[model samples]
Target chain A: MKLLFSNEVKEHRFSLKCIPHDTDMQKIENIDVSVFPDNITGKDIDSHGNITIFGYTKELHDSFGFDVEGTASTGLKDFESAKELHMVGMYKYQTKITAPGESVLDFSKKHSLESCSSNEEKALLIMQNLNNEFEYRQGCTDMDTKAEEALKGGCGVCQDFAHIMLSLCRLESIPCRYVTGMMIGEGRSHAWVEAWDDNRWIGFDPTNGKVVNDEYIKISNGRDFRDCLVNQGIFTGNVTQSQTISVIVNEEQNLIHD
Target chain B: MISYMDICGKRDRVEDMEIYTGADVVNEQLARYGVKFGIYKNNEFKEQLFPFDMIPRVIDNKEFAYLEKGLKQRVKALNLFIADIYGEKKIIKDKIVPEEFIYAGSGYLPQCEGIVPSKGVYSHISGIDLVQSKDGTWYILEDNLRIPSGASYPMIVRGIERRSAPSLFTGKHIEDNRNYADMLRHTMDYVNCGGHTVILTPGRYNAAYFEHSYLAEKTGAHLVSGHELIVENDHLYFIDYSGRKERVGAVYRRISDEYLDPMSFNEESVIGIPHIFDIYRKGNVALINAPGNGVADDKGIYYFVPKMIKYYLGEEPILNNAPTYLPYYDEDMKYVLDNFDNLVLKDVAEAGGYGVVFGNKMSKEEKEKFIAMLKAEPRRFIAQEVIDFIDIDIMEKGQLLPRKADLRAFVLMAEEPMVWKSGLTRFSRNPDSFIVNSSQGGGFKDTWVLSQ
Candidate 1:
């Protein structure tokens, strides 16, 4: 299956670096990008399994934009054979992004999620539980909001849903990470999770209550929401600018669906 | 066998004691030179002088020889631990150390995974604290791998003491500690890939700002702030006061990992360069102590260092850690509960003499409350047997009194692990206090390693 994923990122008073990285399930077919203002050379793969794009810059005064489009073929994975094998950097996913008074294990016990079940079954159950737990209200929480807070408030965006699910999965010792990517149909950008099973990584989007398919393309993954940021800005400008992201996912076969 | 030699100071104990009679005069000179610690509590800044003692803690040449060897071996094992945790993780896989102990702590940073420094050196400078018990056994306290400071205090005070007491210096033989600056420069230069070396400071407001600036001047490296450094084209460039830019090859960054890059770690950090971490990841520049070393020195991870020495180097530990027990294990938790009143409980997350509780001193009601909290969060605490460490004499009201002291030995990992011939011996001011931290009313004495 072929999928096209692209996003347009703009910088205002602060400059942004739009990173191009590789993911597990899909391999990139072709990368089309235009970096304006400046570009730096050299790169390496970090311990987190992310390919670092080094020395790309957008200076102050004018807004520089990056239009990145990539085509990839989704491949089949045998997640069953991956278990009982030691994975380097697995400690990265086991970390809990703690918020004040956020006891994920206590919440799990409250929901009786400690039953003897397979890791995937537990992950799917968590996704289903969180769909009912959250009201799917946008603007209810910001990017820095923790899952424990969102669960208590009863409303959050996809980012919060992913965090809540990540906390629950880590409590069960199931390795999980946060992923920012493009989903099929209509949306600006999507936040979801990828759980490490025996032999492969499986994606679960609790906000939509479904497993991600070939139509989804992962941009980057990290232990928490702080790591998967597509565009990061650091500048000394005194101006406050409101920013927006534009994303479009196109499937190769234009199949009409009900 | 003593690998190196030191010169013995000819003066006896009484003559050395006579030289310290003018300690008050030397202390007043310290205030004039602005040798102070700028402390910030409740968001308010206050400056206080880090008082110095004239009496030196003298160590024989043979004793220094043993300490130097152990310091090298311990730092070597620690560096290997950092490398393994980031890359192979064989220790975790073999079940030599529990994964929960390594990953559960706040110091373990996942962002630092896979970033090997220029020379595979994670801790360029390791400040290993050691305490001598009353029976004369040296016990390891804790390792300060990430920017272990206080090296500058002795480096600066020596100049003042040399000028103030010329008569005292002529009669005694002492190892010159002024070569520390040269050692530091060599360590930084050893890993340089070609460009200039710069000391990147968080700014004057940071606690270790004095050391940062002092070291920059002494080593002849450019002293730069975060604002003065920029990441462009995957290279770190230092901008001069005239606004000219030059590529930086090695950077001794004097800031925490969380505050090093706004793009990588803390998004709200205004004092960090945005893409500097990316530059480091590309291997274009070298970070002094490397990021993600906190996991190795964490109070929780300290329990497994002796095990790391065996796993990484296959050697018995030269130095012994103070008898410690972690509550994370069921057996240790049981021992801690059974001997609650006899042990000193320490919160793993706290440092600088904070979060330490004497179980014997707690009231029964307070003890019950603490035990409940300890049971509720077992990983957050560790229990240790209090060692009655020996004391050095200090002049309190012109009368000599014994107070607990601890030595912080500076180990530089450059051309092999080079332990400084001398160390910073800090003594507590309060008679009963065991904590000899400079932050907790502790004054420092120069450690003299005899050449005899």
Candidate 2:
């Protein structure tokens, strides 16, 4: 059966009041942002399925306001009367693919299935079977939803599908990871999955049975969707602010001409 | 006459215990065994040199016997109190302790109501702090019913001390203090669910990680993290390296109650085992120092322990209190407000040596602010008269000096409450400091209760 892979659709908006503390305001220079890329395909990445070249940041890498920055004063301070800042972003993408024509039990039977059978191969088989059986549906699951729940539901967004696949892979002893990025296609935003096959990592679009190609751009990789959300913040101001997001995805056709 | 002052001088008068002091010293003993404890400051992990004084505190047999009875009685009453608070609320209903005082206290959890522990005991291990007055009267300082630490320190330090002070042991027959591991193993077995026991830690960065690892090594329990445990079909299991799963009999978890189960307590807790509470509720596993025990350890509830002893055991308290005043009571509130400068005001909600404001240390503005807070939230605070306890000499910058010290004695309650022969004796590093908390720059010494 042909498997349908759906991209994660994240419509998120937030406002942060950056209060000028005696310490933090002077340290604040410029805000760096890494928006999920647009216009990408499934064939460009390695087997482990990692694409690190997608998310872009203008600010110095040290000032990215995350744990890598190691700044004590990174988050918005608890201050009064500060005009709270707001940011909004959204994601959407889809791929059509065919599942590998082998059940996990059948695949294991062909393999040694001995006492020395590697956990990694077992995990790959499980992942392959899960992708083959489940249909990707948006808004059917959330970020906190576990893989077992997603599998039981049989339909969920890219985040849920990836998490379910990753968890099953992990259960089989393979180190699987979640990837957040943009696919160059006729879509608003996108996300996908990466798995470690043997010593090498590989990326495949379960939604559209295709290897990730150079057309794909990568943003961040984590255990789940909660780790790679584009933007996260904390603010103290009482008044809430509204946010809106817009994205345009198109393939760069004239690569040699440019 | 070898006065106590002379013995103190013999220990603290030298640059190091091995060179100057005439005591039989085991040099670099803890370093040899890789025995160390960890503490956290400003979110940074630091290893602390486990302070050991060659001069151990000696309590006569009679004094120890009396202390054992009082400690056992106190722990039993506390366990009963916790069971009652979580199940029947009988203590509150009988007006022995105020219901508002309990509900308003942050430690009380309504979610834990009607949930019974495996052995009907709330505090499997209790660390109760006490101090000796100049007149030799013992006073109860506080109770640590939830995740009490430092038992392994005493257990490990005694091994080193026994090797060094062979003469000290010959004169005074001290009972074997090595049965802590056996006691702990038996305690876990008492509540076993037909599986292996494990010590759940929040990982190596936690302040009590050393204790967790040490106790797990000593008691033959697996030291595991949150990622190691899984819940399925309302049963808790540990996933081994070979992918073989084993049911967990008991879990002596070092993490706080709130961080034990993400689904039941704090949803945002990443270090918690998800859905493990359901397994514990289903009687598939036992959680040592079970959840909702904080309600019994509340500082407000501490004031009524003597009363609880009378109410539950119909016996008088052997140890006295240091004149604690609960602000929730009208007359006590008035008394504390009138004499705010002479007492120590402590927030009932805070623990581990925080939220304590000494009346004498507060400035005028601070006192006023505290008074305003007292008026705003009366039940949240308590005041106590500072007891002048006897000072002991400790080594400081290679000098013999006197400093305030206190003892945190462990009371084990399994089938019954049993006090260990030895306890942890902690002293303030500063000469003028009265707070001997490890968080507040204190050092610990070996306690030896001599047997007759």
Candidate 3:
């Protein structure tokens, strides 16, 4: 059976409502987006039989960052599967200039654009740099991450990789977008990336330089990974967070009859 | 001849008494011990409740002796075939079994090539399923050489059944079936590294979790998961609750070959103890059923078991095999394609009762699709004639009903290949259902081979 793929990119404008409104007006400076689109190829279709499109933004909007509230819509398509679907992606909004004298642009510049290269190369360099620069320590970053802070700590997972790469892409003026997609590599998990080069955004595995192939199936996209959040809703009480992602790709043969 | 009345009177003397004319009661008692097996569905654990019947199918001593000889001969031949496939490829040269069938089988593991196992025994535990017809004859149904389960259930059930019907035991001099634990222990001891025996389980949530723990407890072996095992310096070691390290003797691992070694078979396996295959390869530890034994268990390879028995044992097969058709053969492929609706199609690579399509159960379009699939990848599929064995009564909805069932009798090959006197008798719950696999909503009964 041919697994249905119904994701097409169309123009969209989205808005967001930040919780617990920040009263300090001086902390707000700039707002920017780093998302883009890419064309699908025959090779992008997986051998185990599934269509995967993983495109994301790699830009950081720092200076003049406002206590952002509103929606941003883009020309993108929604994902659906007739049988079952395994989707993983993230949409994030990085709050810039949390304190006085810390300009949003400086914070963004300090985190973004340290290296300018192809997505694959950049991902490789980032992994080598992370391995050389930081100690392999866990519990360093949470959902609320600052690229500047993570750069100082020198250790993070794919989320941190996406955040740091987004900041850099934004500094470079690349129309990078944050993408949430299912990674059918050795294991299944959500990964983030910045798309640039005429919306033909390629994925950068900052943890490793493993290029996103047909195995990486896109779920959703936005400015950052937090924007394309899979399960994000405020609960009534103190919630200890726990998450699990399982993706099964089976080899399906479709005998096309004339 | 002792009639049903005599059996009922004997069963009445026991508590929680239920007199079954056949083997189904044994399966019921096994279910009480929580001895069930499991299979994977979409990467989730699903337990299999093998349906069993109460009526005990009596095989006279003379017939059983012949069957015992044939089963041992068949298992020995299979072990030799595995050795040859991994070592010499002599059978292929002799033109007995085709070479492509061995290589094309998904169960054929290239990693096991040239690596000899301890004691040269590839299939230590074999669960060979057999069925008997109403005319009083038995035929081999299937062979499960890789980590076969259900022995513990019968071993435990016999204890309960004997206690429940003590008089039944007094009249029959049935061979004691409790020696399976001792047999398994000795098999492990033959390949031990001077440490304690461990039953390696995937986890508590696995479908065979109950059996893994049950077997471990019954055999005086520690139940350890993949996380509890560590390999250092090409030697296997187990981590204890007291934070101590002890060398592991034998691991009757219930996990598949791919998930047993992350570094070897599948790099993404989190449930596997990384670097453990290296220890097995180095002969520092023994893997029960042994990795790569799947080469023999492949359903496609099953067509040659009788031939294999003849080749290695230099003897004719005592037990008869159901007529099986391998699509890989040109004539067989043509036959299967022509008779798509008459034969049952099975994917040789799939087990736990998945990817089986009965021709009678499908629509015309579905049959066409299967035909196309067979033509496209003939090696991946096999066709078999549906066996219409005798059905026995099972309790359901407060009444007895006849259900299709089969028996998986465990044969332990430590000192010598010995069949467990008790077997797992599984039956289908649905009256119309022909597939009695426990994973497909079946229940089990304890099998009693009556000693006349």
Candidate 4:
């Protein structure tokens, strides 16, 4: 990630959630993080268990950036059962962006979402119907886009697909959440859905219409896309600023089967 | 019971006293002190002087003592509730407060989970609002655990009042309210980790800017803005004009939680000190009225406070909650719909007298639309039986008119809970309106807790 300011800026505070932590399904190793305009860093673990590395740059700087590299051993194991049981109701309710509107509600009713016996089945039904309806496209929806809007627009990115899936599943009282992390073959980070079933969270990728597998590395999960932001910052400068972000994930040839 | 007749007799005596004639001087002094609250209308910010009424709200010694006990008990329970919500899931697991109310509520900040504040106190200063019905029954209206203002208004005005009308107190015995500053200072000191204490303000454009500065002055704590403070080496520091940094251990932040730290909360908050939450999480500094207090004070959660008092304290609530009904319950929804015209509906997500709607006042078509919306989203609203609270006389151009009023009592937590002897008594300027919010052009009066 890189940020360029039109003028010199000081007192820049930034938080990066790009670091992957150890979970039952994935083990992160050999993590190295470097930031420009060197400063003291503080590490904090949010309630969702995401690791946030934050720091302040007091010196004058027109440009700032950070790079994070790590290795992860990924799997499709259901590890969320160890989490507290009280969270099921929290994710069952809808948030601002995931709240079902008239169109989303009608779509849920049309899909007979309540007929599904378990939350996992409802999540799968939501993913199937949303995948059939939505076209994979970028620039049509932004971070602030709601599930209802994205559904009506008939096109969005992974975040939108995840939001729509969450909206539909939550309308049926299915406990679900939004997940953001890296994919083995994808250049950018990906968003997916995880539903609580059999006392464990099962991952589903609505964007690709597939269940999560060993290829995905989960970094953070929350009620919606707003909680999984990789990088956020604020600086004191009147000048215009622009940001550029890119992600690269690779698999070792020995680990990949031909 | 202090009836309306008793208040009228007291009013007759007040009319003969010198304090009644000194109202203009007191108001002028208040204006001179720049005691004003800012409000926004049509996207424009305007600061208006908070008008003061000479007639005070007098509570008998016994009545105030009862109120003090109840307020302290209520605040203690609220503090425990905040701690429990963030610390453990016992409350949710025990099914006392539903998980939906804890997590789904907008006030519930997930970032605050598992972090216990300094001294294990969450609401260091609680502003619990109450109103007295015609029968003299006090009902808990709402709780403002997050940065409750208006106490500074009455605290400052009382000094001017006593100075202007010294003769009024010669015969009558009223508890001196000047001790509020000391009480507030104690509350801050109790939670200080180990260094300088400061009051963090959003700036002069904020609504309660005057209160922020006044409290800082009265308490002798430096009033600093976000930019004046910085976080370094896992500690918060106050940078002076000379470029020297003083370690600040306690911050009575007047800004909301979302705006307290840009690194942890809203990234667009330019008025927030970055990494402050990081230091707070590290237990390096203390944040007064700890972040995520909204989880306890959300209007929806108000319905469960009496329940909380019972659950946490295992005692009967001394004060009553204003006969509320949560639309989320099917039975309450039926009750609300059956007696729709007698109930007052409030949107849980709104505050400052914005989302309140009187059932009888709504037109037929508006009522239908609202009912439909309410049916669609039951958890979004709460309905309450409209209590016909008694009114006090407010002098308008030499004529006395009765107006609806409420009291905001402050409870400061140190080693134990300390209830302020006086409170901010706000009265609706409109005869029919029950909302006494200063943001809606309501006027305030001093509350007199008689020493006798």
Tens digits of per-residue lDDT, candidate 4, B1-452, equal: 55323543444554564446989999999999999999878999999999998888889999999999999999999988888888776778899877777777889887888899898989999999999999989999999999899999899898998899876567677899999999999999999998999999988989999999999999999999998998888888999999999999999999999888877788778888888988898899999989999999988999999999999999999988999999899999999999999999999999999999999999999999999999999988999999999798787776678999999999999999999999999999999899999988999998988888
TM-score of each: 0.90, 0.63, 0.60, 0.92
Least well predicted 10-residue stretch by lDDT in candidate 1 chain B = B1-10
Give me the runs in candidate 3 sitting further than 4 Å from their true place: A1-258, B1-33, B36-57, B164-170, B397-399
How many residue pairs clash (N, CA or C atoms closer than 3 angstroms) in each of the candidate models, in the order given? 11, 34, 80, 0
lDDT of 1 by residue, B1-452 (tens): 11111232333343355545568778888788667777888898777889788777878778888889888999999999999887777888898888877777777777777778898988999999999888888989889998889888888777777888766567566788999999999999998867999998988787777788889999999998888887776788888889899999998999889998877778787777777787787688899989889989888888898999999999999999999999989999999999998898899888888899999999999999999999999999989999898888776765667889999999999869999988889999989899898878799987777776
Which residue runs of candidate 1 sit more than 4 Å off their true CA positions?
A: A1-24, A35-47, A51-64, A75-107, A110-117, A238-240, A254-258, B1-17
DockQ of each: 0.39, 0.01, 0.01, 0.59
Off by over 4 Å in 4: A2-10, A60-63, A76-78, A113-116, A138-144, A236-258, B2-15
Model 1 residue B170 CA deviation in Å: 3.7
What ranking of all candidate models by TM-score puts the best one first?
Answer: 4, 1, 2, 3
lDDT (0 to 1) per candidate: 0.77, 0.64, 0.61, 0.87
Ranking by lDDT: 4, 1, 2, 3
Q: After superposition, how far is residue B254 of candidate 1 from its true place, in Å?
A: 1.6
Error of 4 at A23 (Å): 0.6
Which candidate's DockQ is highest? 4
What fraction of the native interface does candidate 1 get right in terms of contacts?
0.42
